[model samples]
Target: MNLLEKGDDKDIEALSGLGIVSDDKSTITKSTIVEVELDLELEETLKKFGLRLESDGCLNWQMDASAHPRNWSVSRRAFNTSVLLALDLYTTAISTSGPSMAQAAMKEMDLGHIKSLIAFSSMYQFGQALGGVVFPPYSECFGRKAVYIATTLIYCLACVLTAEVPTMTGVCVGRFICGIMSAVPSVVVEGSIEDLFNMKSRVWIIFLWACATTAGLVLGPIYGAYISAYCGWKWVLFTGAIVTGVFTLLLLFIRESRPSRLLAQQAARLQHEKGLSYPIHSADATPNLATFSRIALIRPLRLFFTEPIVFVCSLMMAVSWALIYLFAESLPSVYASLGFTGPSTSLAFIPLLLGIPLSILFRIHDQRVLGRRECANLALNPEQKLTGFVIAAPALAVGLWIFAWTVPPAVPHLHWAVSMIGLVLVGFATNEFACTLSGYLADSYTIYASSAFAALAFLRAILAGVFPLFAPRMYSAMGQNLASTVLAAVATCFCGAALLFMKYGKTVRQKSKFAGHSLVVNRATQVKGDNVE
Candidate 1:
């Protein structure tokens, strides 16, 4: 019989002994192979019976069988792969950090050129916003790997240009290009991890990503400091360019993980093997370029209008981000006025170190204790995840207030570090919680995850870009204490929103087209290889 022939239960059961699982679509199109040191005559007999010989000498036979391909399981190996990709995907945050430090370089080149810094910061923000708009569509159309490669390549070139350029305009242009291209890493992180991880494992991985992001924040400034102090400001761009080039070469290992795209590949391979005209195009096989373009362009706009959950959450996340950038800009000047040395200026960001470890611990605690509590029937709802933010918002406000009040020609350098500790503590909380919420949104909104994020990314890039322009003036006008107090108040308002989410998030999610549908609550109900619209 042809290997594709249907078999009965006994035949399937017997084949199961050989390590195959059966499902509704079971069929095999090739001969089964079995090999062993049977007599030559027996081997010949088995061959005549349509069994193929094996290289290892074990008896191998082909039975007509087709089992469901394992493209959707959230196993240990899959989770590990997802985490690694997520880590790689978020390295774009480094690009964002790079420009903030680039400002410090501008100061070294000329202290009075505040207008130049403002122009650079504004361009960076617009580039970031443009990237946010474009990357979502690209990720949806071409899949994550393509966008990753394309953007990283552009970013690398931009870095090289920035490093080599002699004029302020050249550096500004390079910074803008880098900002736009670097967006892929941030946008791709959630989608890539979700492609492999389910809810329980996703939480831990999200935590890992959050901590990793903070590390970028910590390292980027210090990197800029040393480069500007010792090698001149141009090296800041050169060094980042070199690092991105190395990473770009490392992209060889990443594979296409999008379900729809992979399915299309599989379907193409199957058509070639079937030796037939072609299978009717399924949803997975539809190559409507116009449709993809429309979805890519319009979906995020729709999500922004339709989803209040997305709006509030994104705003909160953006506010936190703006504060981080604002503070980052404030630091060199803040510490300089406090009698700190140029080499030691970057070290002022050392307060961020405490936040990184705390995020990891929080992630571990949630996975071990909280996830288990639900798994063991300790909680009725998964909304307990929102609690992490409740802790973060206040810390943000408190830290900003502390850092603001303590900085100056008056306050000691140690006091700045102390306040920074509080600032980073809040950062750890907001950053971690934001990641968790992102996963939650992905689960809740099946078709619009990328779009929803795109909307939020637009908001985030705008705030992050615009806030720094005001950084000098804000600190200049209100002084450190009051400027920070204003930021702290903004964070405090968002804290109340987080509390609201803790109480009624499910209701909010239920209202979302994207968030409600994307969540995978049970293994049986899991949708595999789904394209987040």
Candidate 2:
């Protein structure tokens, strides 16, 4: 009963014709390569690299060949990662920068209220949610390189529209489009990581990515503030355009990282050249766009509802993300009450960055915990990452409570410094929770981690979109302490999810369609001096 068991993914359904091709072989073993007819030139090329054509007609890299992405030179890997990370940061920053211009746009457009802000801010998030539904599976079908180029181009176009559009209506439209393209990094970047990095190395690489993601969010307000102050609101988008447009060109150089699609292409090339037909690897099927849409769009929603782990973790993450946006929208008022006004409010977001440094400390503590417990995360040990979640969970609650009590406009409001301290704690908690939960999902649903995360992205994006719309009203109704307390209670409630998983996650996985009969059970798993069984 693997938890993430999937049926014939519609992602590949449309490609059955091309994938099966004029000659189809369902099973090809290593020993059968001798019987297959291979192009002489292709054969020569393989030999030159000390590789060979496999019976499956795929390019079989030799043990030491540089053709394997894993074996790519250090410079190549570093260059590729840098390009991908840069693209991710630029795209995400564009999505959040809209708020820096919210007031300016409202004035320029002659709109009086904050409601239209949703049209740009939340709509962009809505687009991001929708993007998650489509892009991850597209990566599985078309390869990461194609998806990156296509999505980045669309994102850059959206930035142009936002910058140049004369009407508020047009800017709102551009924001949604930008948000959709922004999702490409969130949904597909993890799949790219899977393509290049091995298990042991993935943790720290993901840590790097997490930091990059937070950096983008941190950049949004500051970058937008400076641009809006100096050059007006429209120029804020132009700044993103200038940055992302450069990154988009850089995207052209990132080589195909999807192993399945790469091998399929190599095999297809050889077959056409030699007029020889052989079985291809099963994973390389390229489903038609319609089937791809059906599966890609539907799968995340299905997983969001049906998978308990996805449901709980997504809820937790949704709450976290929604809170971040809600706080952003409310920042102007909060600090205004404390006598901080205008663009300086953007600097308030700096506290959110403390999470990056604090997370490094947590990662060190987490690694030490895993080592002392002799825990093998590969052995379906979802609980291995739960410690940080546990520690951070209460901190999130306390932080919310503190913010509620300390933020201005309440009778005898506490110092601004005190409220900021609460923000620091929330930021730290958010980083720890997201990293640990994401790592757990990646480990538990190894094959379907993308979909699991897509569910997370989709749900959180929606929450992030919707929550800010009501944040101001909610604050006005309940005041800071009561409103913060309600939010804190919500955060505290989900913390039980981590506790429950810590106790029963193993037993639940024992019965999962994807993780049941664990492939990893053969490996030793121990914690607290006893073998995990």
Candidate 3:
């Protein structure tokens, strides 16, 4: 039947502009007429609520949409990003702070064995592994602001428990809870910042975030040593609680940044304002248990095992993370052997701090080169992002070898400064390796980048947590030189990962079901299909 013929002149006039009616008053298919009518109604409804529909009939941000986070002013976005960055720094700092206060904790609680001391750090990392998998989905379900506030508050309480509780078990329990809450910042903050900036603008912001996180690892032990030495180890926990409490208050000023949550809120407001009871659908429906299970738990684990890129990246990152913890465990003994005592032992870690800035400078230079290449119309791929990693991998192996030989019996007369130089190399390589690989993963996975990263975080946190538990014993039994040599050898073997990926990454991605399609291409295809429809 001809659908437009039944409509009044006003309806036909409206339909004519939409091309649902012909100038010759030709017959229009029922399906086409119905679809146009439906689109018009949706558009009218959205317009009434200060929202709009794109050509694809999907709700989208208006031009310069004030409500869209990306359209927020530079100062506003930077302020919010700074808050998240602070949280990231604090969480990472606390992760390593345990080893700094371990001796004080053991003496105060009457704990036996160095393993018991290491547990303070180990348990927190274990909780982080589980929480990394768990919290990201909840943030997806709720808004990022709510998750950040609630977790920060809980973390404060956990810190208080750790500080105040006299029993070893009580402190360990608090540390574990703290780890779980801290995982939100580690895994979700980057995603939050992503909500604030587009792909082209966010690279430097991510770099800053990486620097803050890595700085926390080096700074934690240094400050924890001084804080524990003077104010007592309990004060270390107390300080964390105080800082977190301040940030929790600051969180109140941060608005909801998650797009789905913001859209849902707008929809609810529209329904209320129009005196309508019918549901207004949003892009992200409220996730149910099954959806949550699939996104949060199942998908990450599946990708981790099935994807070669994921496996290799996760393993390499895991080892790098473990090396940081291993250094925390072994550095004290190494320096003490050379007659350093008290906070002086912490001085050895200062060289590690130099690596982060050096790495950042190197990355800045690499980025400029890449920018020039792109400007010259050179084709860039995910493998191209691994250039820094390729350069850094050999340095890591060499650094480990240098440290292995320069310490104690291997080259007994070698100045401690030379060993410190090796540490400088190690620190630089570790930071570069982690940051570059993270970028590569994000590029390769695109739409599923979060899931891929969650997988990486899960495995990395678990292995990082476990490595410290045995580090003391391993260093003792194997001796510093031999054990470090073994580590260097492992690093040397993994150096091939950079070469392998750079050479064959595209071929590998082609075989993978998940990574076979680029997000940009998929989106373009979807938009084209919508236009055709």
Candidate 4:
């Protein structure tokens, strides 16, 4: 007879051992056995949770699961990625939009100093610096889609405020709010890309992301110039709002891409359906307040201060990024001195735009070289990502010097297009440097890549904002040649950072507590295979 059929005092004692209790001796039912089975299943789930479970009973994605973002059809993934790229591009463009229309804004507001004018862009960038540190933890805790929707909606409203509000105070406040909202896309797009694509596919997608960022910087001045020239300066902001509003609507369709969040959601549904009381997710499944504080508030600053690799690389990239803003402030005056007027002055940035695509070609070549090394059974390391940076670093320094020497007063009668060659080189080097350094950080940090990037973003935004404030004054006092020379000298010094890391990167990683273990594991796995053979 079954255990339930043989229910007696001993059987009741056994049921009590399983945490099943009944007071009446003759009232034991079949449902009691089902409850015991569920109890046993829950025990197994708890055991798995203790071991850091990824799956529990029916609450996990199976092989070929249609629910996971990575398993989605290529067309669907591409569509989502495209939407994300567009969002990043437009938001970034807003950072520079004020510079091109500064004169119009200054006239309208009766601003006396160019410093006050620079505040329009600088304030926005300052907001971005803060937002970069503030938003990532929220994304980690809540999910990517929620952050995108909420931020983009506020970003649209901020744009409208900047455009419609009459006071200078109102405009600056709006710009600041816009910057905070825009920072979400800057840092979070990488996480979304991680969700949609695997490592091998990420290279091109990341290159595209780098391209989108640089393109935004280049296009911002061009579009802002023309829009302010014809439709008035207010329309420049109005245009941003209208475009962002459309993107906000598009955001509603994006699936949640954070894997942990998705798993938690799946577990919740199963818990409701099965009526299991035991928790299915692991203890660390959701981010708590402590986790949020550590990641969003403390960790990035700690990494930035303590980690040499993060500090040096981020500092170098920050300076290069700041140069873009410096150019935005200085370029109009530079071109205007050469007799270029109105929106035509913005055309000088076209060469910089051309250089971005060329950098992608170099990136593709670097990938092939790395691919061949992998095919030959060589283990890839983070240092291998430095190949592009090694090439780009010296080019950046040399480009600045070229730009300094080719401009007017240094060479009074030289063609304006000749000066643009330096900008072309600068653009290519800057883009490649950003792409390779970001990849190297990701490879080195692995799971902590987001924190590393947040550190980088924070430093880069601060410098980008500050550099433009001094650009006009620096160019005025030191003259273009000496000012550009000083920048080139700084760039030259940073070139050593790439070389130093390339040679000693493995040694550095070996000593790093937070460094990724994938390379070490790959090396061991390969050795094991050879020994087996």
Number of clashes recorded per candidate: 31, 10, 0, 0
> Residue-wise lDDT of candidate 4 within 1-533, one digit each (tens)?
24455535776777777556765646666677577777678656533432122334334444344555667788888878898899988888778776876766777778755645555788888888888877765675567888899999999999899878857788779888988888888877876775666544666777898899889888888888899899998888888889999999998997887655765776665557655443433212445777677555776787789888888889998898888888887888888877899888888888888888777766687678667766877755567667778888998998899999988778888889888999998998878877887777766664456667788889999998888888888999999889989999999997888789888877877776656343342222121121100
* Each prediction's whole-model lDDT (CA): 0.61, 0.70, 0.75, 0.75
Displacement of residue 410 (Cα, Å) in model 4 is 1.6
Q: In model 4, which runs have C-alpha deviations exceeding 4 angstroms?
A: 1-66, 274-287, 373-379, 517-533
Every model's TM-score: 0.78, 0.83, 0.86, 0.84
Ranking by TM-score: 3, 4, 2, 1
Worst 10 residues of 4 by lDDT: 524-533
Q: Which whole-number lDDT from 0 to 100 does residue 338 have in model 4?
A: 79
* Model 2 CA lDDT for position 508: 69
RMSD, each candidate, Å?
9.0, 11.1, 4.6, 7.7
| Candidate 3, position 2, lDDT | 51
lDDT of 2 by residue, 424-498 (tens): 888877777777777766666554567778889998888888887787888788876687879888987866777
Error of 4 at 58 (Å): 13
* Span of 10 residues, lowest total lDDT, candidate 1: 60-69
Model 1, residue 357: distance off in Å is: 1.7
